[model samples]
Target: MASDDEDECGYFYDDEDADEDGVAAFEDDAAPPPERRADYTGFRGGGIGAGIAADRLCGLRIFVCTPNPSSFQIRKGGRCYAGSAAITQESLYTAQKQDLSTVMNLLNIKQHQARALLIHHRWKIDGICDCFDRKGRERMLRDAGIVLQENNSLASGGSRIPVGSAKCNVCFEELPLNSVSTMDCGHCFCNDCWTEHFNTSVKSGKKQIQCMEVKCPAICDEGTVRCLLFGKYPEMAKRFDRFLLESYLEDNDSVKWCPSAPHCGRAIRVGAGERYCEVECPCGFSFCFNCAAQAHSPCPCIIWDKWNAKNTDSENIKWILNNTKSCPKCFKPIEKDGGCNLVRCKCGQYLCYLCGGPTGQEHTWSSIAGHSCNRFKEETAGKSLDTKRQQLQRYTHYCDRFKIHGGSYKVEMEKMGPAVAQRVRLLESDLNLPFAMRDGDWLTRAHRRLLVSRQVLSRSYAFAFYMFGGELRTRPADQATLGVAKNLFEDQQERLEHHVEHLSKVLNAGAPAVHQVENLSKVPVAHVPAMPEAEVVRMKQETVTLAKTVETLCGEMYKCIQDELLPLLVEPMSIAAYRPDGPDKAKELAA
Candidate 1:
């Protein structure tokens, strides 16, 4: 409900001096204008020439930094604003201190009051400040059920105690002053009754316990709640503390826990406007931040969801429809890949593929002798099988390509990745090879590009399938324009697919062999072999060139989708921008 400016202010600015509009006022009259700050550079330098070789080979820049970097910091308006820190049960207090310190410093309020405001506003400093600006200090405090009492002595467990006994409100019994606890709102109640209320609230998962007095809009003091509950209900006290600590994640919109299986116990926090982006968690799981699903882009979440559901059943149906025929003896489906129409099933029944009728064992490739069911079947008036057939064919065309490229990506990642590493080690150890040629990281980079582009190629088919097929097809007037756009998109997709495949092939090509010396008995003699430096150089160049080409094609395909094909749709859809180095790796959180 708060405006963007208010949200930005909350994350970045300290509200020490501010105007009526909630903007922070500069303390100095004459101050230099703020300079543009660089965005978070998570990847840094490679070892000198290796970096240059990588860039030249891939036709893309690669950053290599020493000591590594922390998770990419989310920057806002040229200043770093949001980022996630891993929080353990022991570090919860430390993780929460920064936000608490900011609110306390800006509002000049006590820790408990700051926490109350944060909880009420969902821990959004911007929303709190905006409310403070719009409603003034007193009204904002009142809305969050906080009452700033002047007489500190009247607060619960204060040093001062009443001289006489007091009447307990709930039980209507007179109790000694020390037996009753007074809340911040000056409402007094017997300790036993207070404990019961606090325990019930805590059990019900209520983070903010209100004062028991009717019409009193004050929250119970956390210290009082802890002190009272810790004595009798230590576990409940622990639960209450945990609830308060986790409110930082539960209440804040910008942060989310890594949705990894077995629990990664880490959260990712993005900038205010970055909810729709893809982020990789330190646990090596990359996901769409908005949907928390596997990183699927170039296909909107809605389309991806539908595609997944359809594929689950569609594959089986497709196999049945295209590849199988019912066996005459058992009425069971049997698939014939390529031998003959007269197929024998496990039940020892010979079946005709054309008609699913019983056939004799004596048959040739051309004919099941004397048995024929090739006569044209009459078509029904209302049922057009051709239209249904065409639809299935269309879906198969796209799905086949999608599965092929997707399957290839998995193979390359599993098989080629380690092989490339082994080849790089061999090249580095070869004494005849130049020192500059030893760094074969470019091969790894190219292989990564191949994998990434293949993914794009795979998902693009899904996008095309929905964009140009089915209910989303354009109207008649737009058909010609749609044809043009479709051609352009397909062209890009084809080009990207070709280059990605080429890169895969180049990276998969085995490394040059190094010869090992053989020892023959008595007098020792060593034979040295010359390295195939020229072949190595040529392979390196080819790998780099293919990688660059794949990267470029991927970029072009993404551009066509975003700028050309997507605009044709009535509804808005977006995909994450293509990253040349694969999805950005999340840095580990500092201790």
Candidate 2:
């Protein structure tokens, strides 16, 4: 029998029996000898070994095949995994039909009734089934206002038409039986009145119009609505159809429309994961699904919201508060960049920059004559001055670092990105270089990590500003502990910042030198100097090492914030999970 550790590895195979390819194929009933069985204990925990196992397990013969890559898949041991899908306007019907078909098949109901139940329950088919199991099927249908006809003869138009004229309840007018229509609920109304009601409902944007009878819970049949409005108002009928189709997104909890400017006309359906997770739309716009804003992970939605509101116009306001004073006569801000305390505004009002009071025309360089308003007559003025000074100082400290990283990111994207791409092209075209040396994917990956990590670094300053400063503070005792935690966090942040800058410097330094090729218009090819193999290998190793280091640092910083600093807060805060590859790219919806 296999030992416990071997069993934990989840593989029964022998390394010696395998071919030179290193792939151990297992037969259904063939057990390897005890001495020859592979010791796969090293693969028990996560690492390169575990990654290999995951990939290999997918190629096993027992698992069922699925064409849709985003569809949920089951491993041999019953682990379920699925990727998110992008629901576009073209695939909206197909996306909705999956649930509709499931519900219809389970309940043996028509499409209209299934849709009514789904809309009422917010498209949770599993919840509906569970309810049906707990409280019989009839009660579940009735609760969602779904009524089924027991006999065809009892339904509308099933019984013979009335021999004489019938009185319509809505219009109270006598109409021939053929001119009146009876709904599933057995409420009869004149065809004209019913058409007007359907038209009004459609115009009002009501996707599911209820029965016209007073206090009736039954939803109006979609077919009835379409037939009534198609003749007089074809456009309204089209609008009604669209409204019903879009209800899948508007009402479902697991799906959301992409929050892109100018509208991407696509919605994302998350098959798994929390609602707060971040997703990238196929249109190349990434956003936090929870708040429908640009992707800001590792920062809770609430904190991100507060940070955005606080930062808007904050730098300009702080500069005005710290570096300028209002003119005493005109009340317009005047920044004294140079000469003396005696400053003249564009409005022709001369004021003392220090005291912010009007000065006479006759004034010296150092002091404004008869404008000695610097003395604080009241203690209130002294306290106010101190408060403003502290606030300005605190804001400046955080804003300077934030702006630095933000500006660096923009510059790197605009300048270094194209430079790296060009360098990579040059290397690929060099025939003297080996295939491995020609690949520049490491540089591209490192550059992407640099961009994302720099964003996190910039936002971390904002988080620290609000977390430790006056905006949010804990008890006196907690403050001491928080100070220690803050130091630890800053240390990690500083280390990450140092490495990110180093990576940025190396990538910005430009790619390895390629042989200079001088060409003439008449020459088809130009002879170029061969790059040394050692230099090529060394450059490749350095780039790969730096990329891996940057990725590790970013992961560590995220883990530190999630595990350490956040727990110290009094109120609970949640951030989106760290995704090293960046935001989750939504797969195109399957046809």
Candidate 3:
């Protein structure tokens, strides 16, 4: 593991002037000075905004740029991060360049050829190496749609034409050498045909265009295509360039476009096998990289999808159908607010609520006279309805708690976040305060723990909903074994919930109350009253201790899910492991 300033590229900065180019590296572990800390300008412009504060307040380690003091950069570390990074449109080229140069240098291939190989391997350099070693270089290159050397002799010797002209196989016309193009696959076609083919392929959303000849798998040379098409179709050529640029994300397994709306124009790249992890973008959007949904860890992506679908309009309809019966005559949904088995619809139609059968508007508590539907039916239909009711009740039990914690998270993020930040500024500004007390990272870490725990606590309910409620078809055959597992899971969930709420309470206690915040809003930073020294110590100790406890409990809960619960299932399912700092803020890649 590298230190925060070591810059995950396997380099250490012994001093500030490590780079030969004179670009100073950030080496400090502590945050920037109070005057230099980024202003929270609510996620609108490019400067460090609410999104960065959300990350900082939540426990993420952010390094304020020295050159551009106002800029904030998220350092990747902590549990389950796996070295993920953010690649903006401007930096995508840089990110791709690193990999391209690696493959190019290793194999001594051209840039375009290396790119094709990387795209075919989904940008896994290790996978490419493995294939190269096992299958030999030629086979590996051939598999990746590259035919660099083997057929070059064939193209020159087998296709020698009358010095100045060659017949294109596609158009079957003799064209001068300049007017025709020869592909690496030893196939020659008129330049016009190649351009049309390239245009059609680009329009069809194909990033890699192959040779025009049937049964030929060689990828057409990108430079040649660009040279031929740029003169006649500049717009299409640009679109072609974009397609190739965007392919680094679309074709690669380790990267994905950020799911932020209005197009953040950014893509996230993660270490291989880390696709299941949740990540937060610099744009202030946090999502499960695997599913592109709200960060719902501890719940598998499939379970989250199912839970979301279950909460849609269809569930409301199911609730209506369960509680209400359609009127016999009017066919309108009717609910029996209270009374005997007999009920009257607003349409003046009478029916027995139990069996939903029409009857004269009269009935006793035990029986309906005209409808002999008092007897309980033990048929499959009745069993099905009973099962549905049980399922709905079970869902409601988990969903209510999930929603409650989710709501609390939003409130705390919006209200407590700013309040804590303000307190941090106030404490830092007070010069008379003890140097130890001035560092407010403890409070920020504690509040971040609260936010992350709240999220985990909320999503844990969703996991339980699908796991124990039998929403998933896969379950252990032994009912007693499952029962024991459920108990163990719920025990962990209960403990996590308890400490999360406790942490939240402590954070709220440390932060100024709503009215106090309102009053502090109107006061100057220096004028704000400093928290008592004893109180500050107590709060710091309590918050830091509670944060560690919550972090441990969260890790244990995830262990219960991954190790204890998931293995019992016949079908495979996985959730991202817990990160105490919340999702690691993906570091923005630099060119």
Candidate 3: deviation at residue 14, Å? 41
lDDT of each: 0.61, 0.63, 0.68
| lDDT per residue (tens digit) for residues 52-150 in model 1 | 223222222122222212111211223232433444544555455555655544444445677898888876655665576578666787778777643
In angstroms, give how far residue 515 of model 1 lies from its true place.
17
lDDT of 2: 0.63
Q: Report RMSD (Å) for each prediction in the order shown.
A: 14.3, 18.5, 16.7
Q: Candidate 3: global Cα-lDDT?
A: 0.68
Q: For model 2, give the 10-residue run with minimal summed lDDT.
A: 14-23
Q: Which ranges of candidate 2 are over 4 A from the true structure?
A: 1-108, 121-141, 148-193, 252-257, 262-269, 314-385, 427-429, 436-438, 473-485, 510-531, 567-571, 587-591
Cα shift from native, residue 579, model 3 (Å): 1.0
Candidate 1 vs 3: which has more TM-score:
3
Question: How well is each residue in 12-97 modelled by candidate 2, as lDDT tens digits?
Answer: 12211221111121222233332332222222222443342343232331222132211223333432224467998889876776
Clashing pairs in model 3? 58-448
The residue-by-residue lDDT of candidate 3 on 1-591, one tens digit each, is 123112211121111111111111123323334342222111112333323223322332333333333233545345323477899888986677666655554454555678899998998765675576578667788887787632354433444322367788778998986677666666778888998998898888777888998978888766666666676887777787788778888888888888999879889887655778888888989889889998889888998998888777576546644654589899988764321235689989887554567877543322433344322233523455677676565565566567667877887787788788887776676677788678888888888888888888888877887787665666547667777777777767766665675677677777766556767757777565678888888988888998999899899889888888887788788888788888879899885
lDDT for 328 (candidate 3)? 84
What pairs collide in candidate 1?
44-63, 44-64, 44-65, 45-64
Cα deviation at 341, candidate 1, in Å, is 29
- Best by TM-score, which number? 3
lDDT of 2 at 172: 88
